[model samples]
Structure formats: C-alpha cells, structure tokens
Target: MGFFKQVFKSVFKNIIDLSRPIFTFENNELKFKINSEYYYTFALNNYETKTRHDSYILEAYTINSDNLFVEYVHVDNDVTWNGLASSFFVNLFKEKLPINSMKIIEKKEFEHYEFITYKINDEFTLNFIYIYEINKDNFIIEKNAELYINLLQSFQKDYKYKFDKNQDLEFDINISIVKENALNGYFNLSN
Candidate 1:
C-alpha cells in the first residue's frame, strides 16, 4: 500500500511539472520552455536609478522576434507606482521614463490609471506617454524613437510573468513584487 501511495504522488508531481513553464538562461540567451517546446527570447533592463535612499527602475522585454513590450518599474525597490497617462503631452519634447521607450500597440485606461501596451514595428507605431499625479500638474513625459537598453539586472522572484506558446498567442508584461519595500513604506504599513 505504501508503494502504491508513493507511485501516485510521483505521478501527480510529474503531471504538475509538465504543465509548468521552464525558463533557462545560458550563453547570455533567455529561453522559455513550455510543454516540451522552446522559444528564444530577449530581455532588457532598459533603465534603472538608485540614490542612497531614493530610486526607481524601468524595464522592458520582448519574445521571439515579437514586437511586444513588457515593462515593470520599481520605486525604491518596491513594485508599485502608476499615474495618469495623458495624451496631451504626446508631442512634447521632454522625454520621461517608460513612455519614451514604447511603441503604441494597444492602450487601456481607467479613471486614474492608464495602461499602454506597445509594439515596435516601425516608426508609425511610435507614441508618447505622459504620466502625472492625480489632479496635479506635476508630470513626467517620455517618448523616444531610440531608447536602447543598457545595464541589465538579473530577474528577481517578485515579478508576475505569463509566457504562453499556444495558438491563441497572448503577450503581456510581468509585474514582480520586490523582496521587501524600502523602510517598509514611510508609515510602516507594508512588509
């Protein structure tokens, strides 16, 4: 009976493993494996900032020659912060983070939130994103045709990523949570 139980557990674990995606990084290349198939992918850390006790990071990546752009940002090593992305600054010359390095593919928005998923096909898909605080004039404008990726950081475990190889073909940005917030948030309300 014990032998039968062990076999059952092993089979169950194997089944679970088969359904999961395997990510491999070797020879400076990123490969994603799903269901026995492998895909070649390229990722870039784009931009990052660190200042003793204040900083933020910006990142973007695509897969297998696709024009998808997945971005994630961290403020003081915390995975959070989004403001209203307005089109008013579309033609502004001031380049700000994130939006400057994207090509508009699809965009979605809420009252105080705006999500833009871009595709870098050519110059036509190029667009701008201007983020500003709610009901405030303080704005961060970004838009550049040639925002190259420079410094890179290893992937942290606190991100949300979805990689699929099925026929449906869905692409999305992965948002990972930081190991911990800086000083646990000014008011001590976070971990």
Candidate 2:
C-alpha cells in the first residue's frame, strides 16, 4: 500500500499544480513570479554549445523564446536565483559591448519580488531586472520567462534596447496578438 501511495503521489504531483498560480492577470497590469527551483534545476544541467561564448545558449535561447526554460534552453550555471538573473543581464549586455567590465550596481530582494541591477557599461541603469519569484513547497516553476515575454508582448515593456540585444529587431507590422480578458474577482497576487 505504501508503494502504491508513493507512486500515486508522484503521478498526481505532476498532473495537478497544488501551489501558487503560475500566471496571474488582473486590473490593467500583469505580473509574473519566476520559479527559482526551475531556474536552479535548469542551471544545474549541462550541455554543448554551438558558439564559443560560454553563455551563448543561455542568453540567446532565453531572449529568442517567450520563456526562459523553453525547449531551446541548453546552458549551465552555478549561481542562485539572483546570480542567474545577474548573469543573464551580464551576458545579454556583453553581446554588444563585449567589454570585460561587468559589475553589480545594485541588488534588492524583497519578500516576494527582487531586482538585480548590473553596470556593464556607461548606461548600466538600463540593464536591470525587477522580477518576481514562485515557490512551491520550495519547488520552482518557469514563471519568470513567462512574465518576461508577456510583459513585452502584452505591455510593450522590454529592456532589449538598453543592452542593444535586439536593437535591430524591427517590427514592421503590429502583429502582436493580445487577449484582454477581464479578471473575475480580486486576486491577491502576494506570493
């Protein structure tokens, strides 16, 4: 009976999310809390790169895709939540600057959300991350990527210009498909 219970528990855990909501929408604003465990797990794995830059895969995939831990993620890291976010900005900015001068300008981790600012160049203030986190019995989900993409898609909010990451990306037409659904009740997005 114990064995059966363990198997069922494992199966059910994957089927249903018995934790905080991964994506939340309300009011005229949308917020996201990236999953720390998923970020750590993805960082823990190893992979082969198609470029010489150590962070090529990590930066490119995370930027190209709408989510960070998408199927294209094929990189590794040894930093915590803040550290990885830090690296993501560093590698991102370094792409254009290519200057070996990256430093932490500021770091603020609140009870729910956190921000890590990096000074990779003269205009470092532009390259910062004010993101949220999701914790499920200490388990992490891939909400950060979702928020990043959604923020840029639904909100037209992005920092690609600051780092010159996608400076050449020209959206000739307004093909952005956004679904504006009214949230039913008050959702205390205090995770």
Best by TM-score: 2
Task: Estimate the TM-score of every prediction.
Answer: 0.26, 0.29
State in Å the error of residue 32, model 1: 2.1
lDDT of candidate 2 at residue 2, scale 0 to 100:
100
Error of 1 at 107 (Å): 8.1
Provide the clashing-pair count of each candidate structure. Answer: 8, 1
What would the per-residue lDDT of candidate 1 be over residues 11-89, giving only the tens digit for each residue? 9888876654343334534343323333435443433322222234332222222323322222333433332224323
Residue-level lDDT of model 2, residues 40-59, one tens digit each, is: 11222232212212221232
RMSD of each: 13.9, 16.5
lDDT of 2: 0.31
